[model samples]
Structure formats: structure tokens, C-alpha cells
Target: MAAPLDLDQLQTFIAIADTGSFTRAAEEVHRTQSAVSMQMRRLEERIGKQLFEKDGRVNRLSEDGERLLAYARRMLRLNRETIAAFDDRRLEGHVRIGTPDDYADRFLPEIMARFARSNPRVELSVICEPTVNLVEQIRRGTLDLALVTHDDEKGQSEVVRHEPLLWVASSNHAVHEEEVLPLAVGRPTCVWRRAAIDMLDQMERDYRVLFTSWSATVIIASVISGLAVSVLPECALRPGMRVLGESDGFGTLPDCRIGLMRGHTGQPAIVEALARHVSESLDNITLPASEEAGMFDFAAMMAMRPRRHRPNMMPGW
Candidate 1:
């Protein structure tokens, strides 16, 4: 395999190309003239490309040098971004993060894996609960941060992602066609449940609550068993489930606004680290090309992403 390009050498090369003189370029980088010359020699040998050509008494970039200069600047800029991402403190110690049961299943795998890989010494504590309880914990200082369903009426949060709120039913059954629709929904505090009820009421569609739970597993079980239809975000759709659309008289529901709620305490390094990771992961989360497919190619979709490392699956929700 080719050896990795040296960042320091690239820095020096960029300096020489900019200053057009070894002595001044050395002064620009705070290196001795001989040292700068040595670095350039090594850089040329490393790439087998002569980056500088003599022009009168000054140094001018060869065609390869001009091409490499752009790449060098980009690499250094990325290095700065990478360093800035970690908060300015030792990122260690335990951080507590909460999310609803549904979000835990749909998003935590990538969030937890990426955070743990980046900050191995920083311990993580996770809680799976309803968004109401998660919001309360943030206020009470019992949690460092939370991934929540954003509601501006309730409080402030950083909205990170939005997903379509979909009416869903079991693919194998006709439960949705019942004269009085039986519905499995979350506790009243769930924004998704509220949107589902409000839109149904607006359409004057008759419905009855058959089951209520905060657990995604229970809700999905109710859905897959064809006992009742439910509303869910795009990520929560699973195999054996089908979306109910306008053709089925299911009106449009409000989007699920996923937010990051930080605790009242000023941001700490570890907390900020996890918060950034969660936002980036969720932002990367994508919907299927067709919702009707009812299947997410999880592995195939995420395989192309580069991960520094991954431990075992996150501690159970």
C-alpha cells in the first residue's frame, strides 16, 4: 500500500508554493531554510514528483505542484474541522443520553457506535423512555442530553431531522378497513399520536384506541398482528407493515421533528461529543427510495460509511 501523505510535509510544500522562495517560506513556517529544503526533498521523493521548477532566481510550482496544492489545502482544512468537532476539554467521564423507545431502535445503533468509537474512554449511559419523561429528565438535571420529538410549544430544542409521519397497517390484514378503525398508538404525550388523532378527527374518520404503549416493540407487535393500525415515522416502518396514504383516506400527518435537548447545565465536553455524534448520524439517516417497499437495506446503506471502530451493539434499550 502507498504510504500516507505527511501533513507536515504538505504544509511546508504549500508554504514554498505560496512564498516562491525557500528562505521566506521557511520564515513563514518558522523553519530554518535548510530544514525547509530537506522537507521539500523528502516530499518530492515521497511522491516521485518534482513539485518545483526554477524560474529566474525564484521557485515556481510545476504542474503537479499546483494540483497538489489544492489537495493540501483541503486536507488541512479537514484536519481543522476534525479537531474542532471534539469539545475543548478532556472528553472523558460518563454522559447520560435519553431517547424515546422508537428512536432508540431506529437511531441509537449508529449514534452509539460512532460516539463510542470516537471517545472510547468516555462512558455512556442510555435511557429508553417516552419523550415526555426524557424531556423532564433533562430539566431535572438527571440526563446530560436527550433525543426528543421537538415541540416548540413545550420548550426549546435543536431540531435535527424531520421524517414523514405515516399511517401504517399490517400488510397481510385488512384491519384498517374496519368500520371503526382500531388503532395502536403511543401515550397521549407522543406528538405522532396527537397528529394521527387530530388529522383523523378533521377527516371525521371513526376510530377507537385498541392499544397504548411507549415500547416500539409492543406497538409494532400490535401493528404486525393486524390487531390495529398505527402511525409511525418513516424510520419506524418495518417489514410486514404497509403505509396508508391518501388513496386509503388517510390524510397527511405532521412531520416528526427529531430534536436534541441539552440539559440546563452548561455544555460539558462529553455531553457535547455525544450530541454532535447523534445529530450527524440522524442527519445521515435516509428514507427508502419507495416507502411502499417497507424494507430498509440497513447494512447495504450503511456499509459505505467509514467507521474508525465499532464495539458490540449498544447496551440494551
Candidate 2:
């Protein structure tokens, strides 16, 4: 008869995989480093497969370890769901989550507040990064969930919300009319940046990249300050910004999509619950029935603001 696998050891294994160091894994799992080491030793013996290997100063997963990771995540997720199905108390635990600065500005506040109220015991550890970095963290088992910009070429994600991508410039400035147009955009890997450049190239428009950054604040600031023009989501329409259209020589842009990605660490109940909240929260972000014919006004959405304090850097939603 086959021996049963140990759930405690599996949990410890996942911690080590996430941290990439026995010491850090020990801190995360609340066990001594030696104790964590012993658990891995036993885990390897139980499965008769070497799981870890030495890499410079940190531990790296061996080929077999990578295979086990998926199974371990699945088992742990199932166990959590089973417990949650029967537990009488409110759901609890930590959720390591992330999103790019753009979404962080628009979606996170309400989602955070709603999630906290419903699951007060669930601790939220958040990070703000670009989609590439966020997806990398998910692959490394560091992030439980992330709201990201969805692009097929960058990373695969379950798209949750779609918003029209629009070009905008300062309502009071003529920056967009510069013969050699100055533009502020995200890093080279950004899909929005690629789209802007591609359209310009097709139009044979003279242009120059005046600023490149992964930060939405920096890009948006450049536009508001009349330093450069930029493409932004509908929700990013600030008070001084005006949407550009065909008459302005800027072509219509496709919809920008928001997606969710998860890590192998599998906090399923917590992650899925948060994912639902994220989707529902984005549904509240609405634009006028038609694009505004005048300078974009953020105050028009004031009625949509939640009856709560809005965080700095948060967008009007």
C-alpha cells in the first residue's frame, strides 16, 4: 500500500518554494530553519524524489520539485476550501496581492475596503508593479493574486474588465500640436506604448518619446503639465485632460483590458473571494453614455465615489 503524503510537510515545502531560502521560509511558516529543513528531507524521502538543489547561496527547486509544486498547490487549495466549507467562523488568513500602478490608482481602494469589511481577519499584503513583474512574482509563488494589464504577448491572464483606451492632452495646452509631437508613455514592453508608436508610424507623424516610465503618475503628470501627450484609460480622465479624436489627428484606440493572475501558492478561498470583489468593483467604473465633447471632467463621476475616504493616488471610479 502507498503511504499517505503529509499535509504539514507539503505546506512547509510550499513556503520554501515561495521564499527561495530555508531561513525566510522558516520565518514565513513560523518554524525554525532546521525544522523546515527536516520537513523537506522527509518530504523528499516520502516521494523518493530529490526536491531541492544548492544554487549560489539560496535553494532552488529541482526538476522534481517543480512538478510537485503544482500538486502541492492544488492539494493545499482543496484542503482550504474543504475547511472553509465547514468552518463556522469568518474566513481568515493572509493574501499577498499586487497590481500595476494604473489599476492601483483606480481599482484597489474600493476593493481593499470591501474585502476588509467582509473578511476582517484576512490580512492583505499588496505590491505595486508593472504586469511583467507582477506575473513573475505569481510564477515564483510570491503573490497570491494580481490585477494586471492584459496583453497576449506579455503574460496570460483572466481578463476581468475592459475600458476604452483614449489619447489625451492638456485641455489648456497645445502640446499635441507640436510638429515633432512629444509623448510620455510606459516602458518599451508596455502594450500601450507600442500601440501609440505603431499608430504614429503608420500615420507618418513626426514624434519623439520625451518620457518613458512604468509609473502612471509620471506619465499622467507629463500630460497635465503640458510637457507631452499620452494615451490613458477613460477612468484616467483628469480635470485638465481632453480626449483626442479623429479630428485631432489621433486615431481611436482599442479597449484596454484588466486581468487577474494567480500564483501556485494557492490561497484559493481567499484569492477567489478577492478576485470576485475585484471584478465587481471594476463594474462600478463608468464613463458618460458617450465620450464627453468638452474637456474631460472627473467631477462628473463624483456621484460614483464610494461613501468613504478616497486614498491618494486613487482614481475616480
Candidate 3:
């Protein structure tokens, strides 16, 4: 008889692949790092294939791991649906969902698509804006729900994912090697922009803002063309960019908290339902740690991108 796949191990595998580190995976699953490591070993043995490979200090998904990721996501989603079919309550209402363009590009489509399938009556209207503006909109009840990137540890926002800020530049461009670092920054209110500048100031490093915009694509384009470097969450690392670490002489940056904020107190059920769905969907997101490698499907991300030009800044969001 063939060895059966353990759902727990499969979950662990997805977490590791998603987070790009066993340590982060352990945090995700609420297990010790050693325990996560053990689970991976057992899972690989059962599958009879290596699932991850070492890339510098991080463990990247192997080709087999990448292939398994697709299956794992579908299986887990189906598994949740199968189990919820018996007792799942129908969720219905208008949910005004808002997020920065970058996150909307990376994770929103999948989340919204799945939510729509599960709750056909739930009307979802999305807004893409800067985090600072989005938070204000949420507070004023202009938006029912928002996902934002924040550095506040004391805030009441329900955190979805937490990761450190990473210094990123195009792999083809050696922007970081310049004496006076050029920066492709967001608007003045951007948390990532603030964090990056503060770190540079503390380090007494010289930097010049080459470009500032609310559009993430513009910033990425600047970096890709060797115009400047930018700080972003680990999840934003794409195929063309590289992550700069301490060894690269960049000062450490503060961690970012991506969280959900509720603006309207009314319709608790719908808000909670969407909030729960967002949490579950985000939990499965796997961002590449650096440019030379990533387990995520960039093609899927490209496909999910909306046709029209949308404001696309907000690093942590």
C-alpha cells in the first residue's frame, strides 16, 4: 500500500513554502522551528522527493515543491469546502473592500474569487488607495473593510501576515552598489518609505529620492531600470529583483504588519465572514524571499492583475 499524505504535514509544507522560512512557517502553524523541520523531513520521505532547496540562507521551493504547491492549494480549498458544506451558513451583504494596489494585485483576486463562489449574494466593491488614506477612510466609515500595512504594534488591527522590510533592487541593476543610494519611494505617508529613510538616517547613509509615486509599478520599473532601490515586504520580491540583507551593508529595517481594519460596525456577519475569508486566504500566500528564486507563480499574478491602471503603492499593504 502507498503511504498516505498527512493533511497536517501538507499544511506545514504550504506554510513553509509560503513564508520562505521554516522559522516563519513554525510561527504560522504555532509550532517550534524544530518541529516544523521534522514535519518537512517526514513529508519529503513520504512523497519520495525533495521539496525545498537552500538558496543562500533561505530555503526555496524545489521544482517538485512548486508543482506540489498548486495541488496543495486546490486540495486544501476543496477540503475546506467539503467540510464546510454541511454547516456553512450563507453569507450575504455589501462589502466595500479596500487595499493598496500591490496587495490587490498579489492576493485580492484569489480571495475575492473564492469569496464570490462561496457567497454569491455578497456584493464586493473594491478600492485601491494608499494605506494612510485607506485607514482614514475606514475610520470615517467610508469603507467597510480595509487591509493595510502598518508598523504600529499597539494598534487594534487584526494582523494577517508579518514580515521584515527588505531592501530590493533589480537583479540586473547594481543600484545598491552606488555610494549615494538612490531611492524609488512612495508618497510621504508610506510606512515603508518612512522606515527606509529612518534606517538610512540612523546609519548616516547618503540617499536621494529618485522618484516618488503612489504607483508600485512605477517604483518597480525605476528599480528595474537601475534608477533606484526600494524597501518592500518579503512577499513583494519578484523574479527581477534581489533582496539586500545585512551582509550587503544595509541597516536593518522594522518589521511590517499587514492587518485588517473594520470601518463600519453594522452587518457584523458579512464583515466577519469576509474578514475570516481574507485571513484564511492570506495564510496560504507564498512570497518569494529574493529575486534569484521564488516558489510563487508570477504568471498567475500577472494574470490576476486588472486591466486598467490602478494606483499601486503602499509597501506593507
Candidate 1, lDDT over the whole model: 0.77
Q: Residue 227, candidate 1: how far off, in angstroms?
A: 0.6
- Regions more than 4 Å wrong, model 2: 1-87, 287-317
lDDT per residue (tens digit) for residues 1-317 in model 1: 99999999898876665555667678889999888888988989998998777655555677898778768866765664466557465466888999987888779998887777667667888999888898889889999999988885775688877677788898899999999999999988778888999998999999999999988899999998899999887778788887787767888777777889999655486787688788667755665456534353334223222221111121111
RMSD of each: 12.8, 16.7, 9.9
Candidate 1 has its poorest 10 consecutive residues by lDDT at 308-317
Residue 317 miss distance in model 2 (angstroms): 35
TM-score of 2: 0.64
Cα lDDT tens digits for candidate 3, 134-201: 88898798888898886474474777776666788777868898999999999887889999999999
* Rank order (by TM-score, best first): 3, 1, 2
TM-score of each: 0.66, 0.64, 0.67
Off by over 4 Å in 1: 1-90, 288-317
Ranking by lDDT: 2, 1, 3
Candidate 1 backbone collisions, by pair: none
lDDT of 3: 0.75
The C-alpha lDDT values of all candidates are 0.77, 0.77, 0.75
lDDT top scorer: 2
